[model samples]
Target: MLFVAAMLAARPGLSQQASLEEKWRALFAQTSPAAAEEHIDAVLAACGDSPAALRKLFACDSAYPQLGGGLHRRATTVVDGETRYDVEYVVRVPGGYSPVRSCALLLAAHGQGGSGASITAMMQRGLGAEVEKYIIVAPTLPGPRRYAGAAYQEQAYLKPLAWARLNLNVDDDRIYVSGHSLGGHCTWHLATMFPHLFAAAVPMAGVPLFEGSPYTSNSYLENLANLPVWAIWGELDQKGPGTLSNVHFCRMAAERLRQLGNSKFEGTELPGVGHAGWWPKPEAYARYLTSHKRLAAPEKLVHFFHRARHGRAYYVEAIRLARDELDFSRRPQPKLRVQPGESLAEAAIRTGKQVYDKSLFKIWADLDKGANAMSIRASGVSAVRVYATEGMFDLSRPVTLRFAGRSWTGGISASARCMLTHYAATRDATAVICNEVDVDSAGKVLVRFGPSGGGETAE
Candidate 1:
């Protein structure tokens, strides 16, 4: 009897029960569908009948089918603060799609006032045979707002991507993003804001928004230095005054990419075409998209954002923004002085009134294992704060930061309580690690550690 019981306990599926319980605990701690989906299959197979609460925990009744490729309309409930939204998305799978084989995924964003159904129909018409080769996902935007702001990127684009990754056998190296018109603007924004998520980007008849301007500036274009960006625009397309022509903007963005030493950037201007011309040429877009694959780990990354919510780039995560408001003059500059034996609580009270101008940024690498140093440069910014982690450098060994004929060498360290406090306030998990330093008056800030370990971690 004992031998028989041991055999049953040693079964492959039964052994996963404990892991399932641990995953459920983590899932409930952060109420996200993506987290739940990570271990859903294993949990369902291992303890589906044993735990009555497991079904309720994941709302498993609403789970969609994972097999048989076709058009699938799925709705997910997303909660932000006190409000809950029933977000719906359309996923079209090729007839040949198989659970055993991974397929390329394309996230298609619709134009203003358009639904996922409409964009899927457009793709069906335009892509023809190419549509069957990839899994396409289109998400509906909430209300009448177009893909004009960060809200659309967060709710519409990112939510659908997360859903597809969880539900489908998506090729992580082949994931791509594309959009037309207003969606095109969002494509640029998403590509820059989260470059690591995409292998390539296609922005057609759209302009990137930057600093209250319709078109992306040269300074902001540096964020896409490591991305393979292909932009398309109609030569005859025009917006109101103070806005540059879409064709001109694409050309300028491509030139900026080239100036930054990116060789994969390309811009195409369609002559004798209007705002809606690119819709019929999905073959061209497909060819470009298929030629590129995502670089899972890159040697260097650069990202800049005005808000803490948009802080993540490829390998670096922004813990805090330079200032909440774009105007630097309005930001409070705190004066620091130690009077005759002031209490710590009093110093904290005084500092709390002042603006925390010290923005924090962190990079994950195992530099101690190799000998190659990472180089970085930024313009049109006051100062940059950088932290190296994941054993990127020997904390005890001296690391040098050189810029503008000046250099600073020191062992980097930060208070764990300070990092945790900032994360508690901003809800940014990436800021919890330590080893931080700040570079003042940044022009070209170079960090000479050692070679990289070539391992990848989240930004």
Candidate 2:
């Protein structure tokens, strides 16, 4: 790993007061555009000073409506039991000090050969000072950005945000996050490990979620219901192994979020760009920062829709993939409509429940003009628990419902609700009620129920 060693050696030589922005530019010239961002992030990590010293030296112009930012270095204490290292961070605060205002935070973790420097540079110049209205903290991640303990490294950085604020005046509501490569890996760790922490995330060219629990990490990952995230990848980048289901991971993640009724989930596969394309489109990501909004970036809506739709579709497909008997078979070109926020998973969990916001579903019963339909079968349900709004209920069209009874016939019909449920899965198909309807049989005879009232009939 001499290559890795040389990159880490580039650090100690970095001046404590080297220009964060200038170094970023030079890094761009010295390294491939892809590695430059991480390198710059590395420089930032090496520039740590004591917290008290930083408080005095940390200076900036007042954050204007969209004009504010500068190089700020600070070292905060990180305590994990008795051992504590001075974790450094370079911040680009959007605006200057003002009255109490809500803030969004973008916590950038550096990859191997990089530190807070490049991450800091990215926050300042790439996204610009107008982005400073919110605080962007880039921490110097450990071990030259190694994968081992990355999840803990992420959690280590995030824990102090609240604790640091307990002594300061940091706002807790508007934190947003993202990272690239190894840092992106850390971002994934942080987001899922603590999904309750962010509004949205955009992970660029990082590893897909792996099961880190049982052996090392404390737990395994379930489909998250509270967080909405967007993942990004370069189609050709293999240095970080971006080819392994990275796009599919984001797509599936978006689908899961949709199942939670959150249509805001997003992911994008940036064509032709590799791991280092952050510079070319950094501005496109500026708005998700929670403090600044870039009106000029067009990709915002485009990426948003891509992930949302893919996420919605995936959640719907998962039920069939679960293959709960019904002798399920695949169909070509299944027509499933998308309700506003319904991710594939969120929709499936809502079957047979009350819906306050009808906007969050792709109920097969809702299609007015579509000519095709879907069918399902169920056996038994130990406990048909509705999915908690803050719980997993990913659903979409062509959904499969599980209930009790001998496959009933006679043109029966039903719809989905925003409510989610957990039908204790088993090998026996005789537990829960299953939805069964074919394309031609879809619109003809309809029986349904509503939140306002309930009635059953044959259409």
What's the TM-score of each model vs. the native?
Answer: 0.62, 0.44
lDDT of 1 by residue, 343-454 (tens): 4433442342233223322232222225323343443334455555324555556665543335555545333322322322222222233334445443334332221312
* TM-score of candidate 2 to 2 decimals: 0.44
Question: How much lDDT does each candidate structure score?
Answer: 0.57, 0.40
**Residue pairs with backbone atoms closer than 3 Å in model 1 (clashes):** 370-451, 371-450, 371-451, 372-450, 372-451
lDDT for 350 (candidate 1): 39
Q: Which regions of candidate 2 are displaced past 4 Å?
A: 1-70, 76-86, 149-151, 209-223, 241-262, 279-283, 291-459
Off by over 4 Å in 1: 1-65, 77-86, 215-219, 239-242, 280-282, 321-369, 372-459
**C-alpha displacement of 9 in model 2, angstroms?**
57
